[model samples]
Target: MKNFIIPAIDLKEGKVVRLFKGDFEKTKVYSSSPEDMAKLFEELGFKRLHVVDLDGSLEGMPLNLPSIRLIRKAFSGSIEVGGGIRSVETCKVLHEEGIEFFVVGTLAVREPRTFERMVELFPERVILAVDSKGGKVAVGGWKEESSTSPQELALKYENIPIWGYLYTNIDRDGTLEGVDTKPYVEFKGYTKKPVLASGGVASLEDVKKLMGIVEGVVVGKAIYEGRINLRELL
Candidate 1:
């Protein structure tokens, strides 16, 4: 674990929603305006924000850039976005809109050539999200399974100057069952990339637990449901 980053807000069609292990049908909407939640996170003293476009990513459409930009404007901290960001042009658009980090998942796994090109173009601005279910990497919003493991693909781009890896144990994601720290700790043993954990963070104790494995963990549901505090984190 490492320094505990603040709460992350995941949006789908302008609402704050979280699903169990990336299951779209299993999603639960918490807030109608993600912007409000983001503004609160900023005002509360967080230094970074994780905002995702769940709708756009699953449909293979362009990212929910409007929501992303709105959050950036509302936030005082750096904002990072993932989902539906499949092209260099789209990446640049998010960058220009004040997004400090761009997480590329499906594209990184499904299209290696493009991921390589993006690595050359954006370098540290990009992060490869290795989302997995039962230890096998999944893509297209975790609805499809791939043969590779999170660490396997992480090593492919580990040598590059990309920002880092956003490792999400889909099995533990959004369940609030507790974080699956084993994979994160194991992934850290293989590469030195700064890994930001996604999903399964339920309490401050969990934050303290991850401090020995990676740099930060992105908490979605826990923060939304008043399970954690944002101000104390930053």
Candidate 2:
């Protein structure tokens, strides 16, 4: 199996930024133009991109459609978007706009029936996001904690056609330390679904460690903070 080194573009009010441990107030602005960042990632030969709308995640609805459109128009590579994706209509709108995958959190755990319906409608395009803190799932932009565990949630979708599960460790997010590989290892052990690891990927070595174990790793703050060089990683 081939491991993917995916770059991330977290958008807040149309600008690209990264939040510290999922906190909205503690944000680090990277670039003003998400389109430029997307193009740069494509130019660097990254095959995939992860775009999240921070504002939308907090607001419970997409707030960066224009930015998403601009990034899609600028880069032709595979793009997966998440944040504020609660309804099927939002998924349709994004799919029509050229997004190849939809990452759904909060709603997937809160409303499994609705998420199952979306998976039924868009088979391989939906990616279930299991954002967790203290072994429990976090929702609504990581502000609220849910009773469900990541493993519990992944098990619930065993019979569904979800593309995979995007597991993010909220504590390590944007900290630029190192990933807590235990959860991912445990998650992979429990299910056959493809897993994408996110949060606290601080160096190329960290990516290398996660490589075959996960289908992909989402690297955000490290790249923005110059801790890891994208050109070398690609």
For lDDT, the strongest prediction is: 2
TM-score for every candidate vs. truth? Answer: 0.94, 0.97
List candidate 2 segments past 4 Å from native: 1-3
Candidates' C-alpha lDDT: 0.81, 0.90
Most accurate candidate by TM-score: 2
What is the C-alpha lDDT profile of model 2 across 55-149, one tens digit per residue?
A: 99988889999999999998878999999999999999998998999999988877878888899999988999999998899999999999999
lDDT measured at residue 83 in model 2 versus the true structure, 0 to 100: 97
lDDT of 1 by residue, 151-214 (tens): 7898888888899989888888888888767888888887887898877888888777888688
Residue 55 deviation, candidate 1, in Å? Answer: 0.8
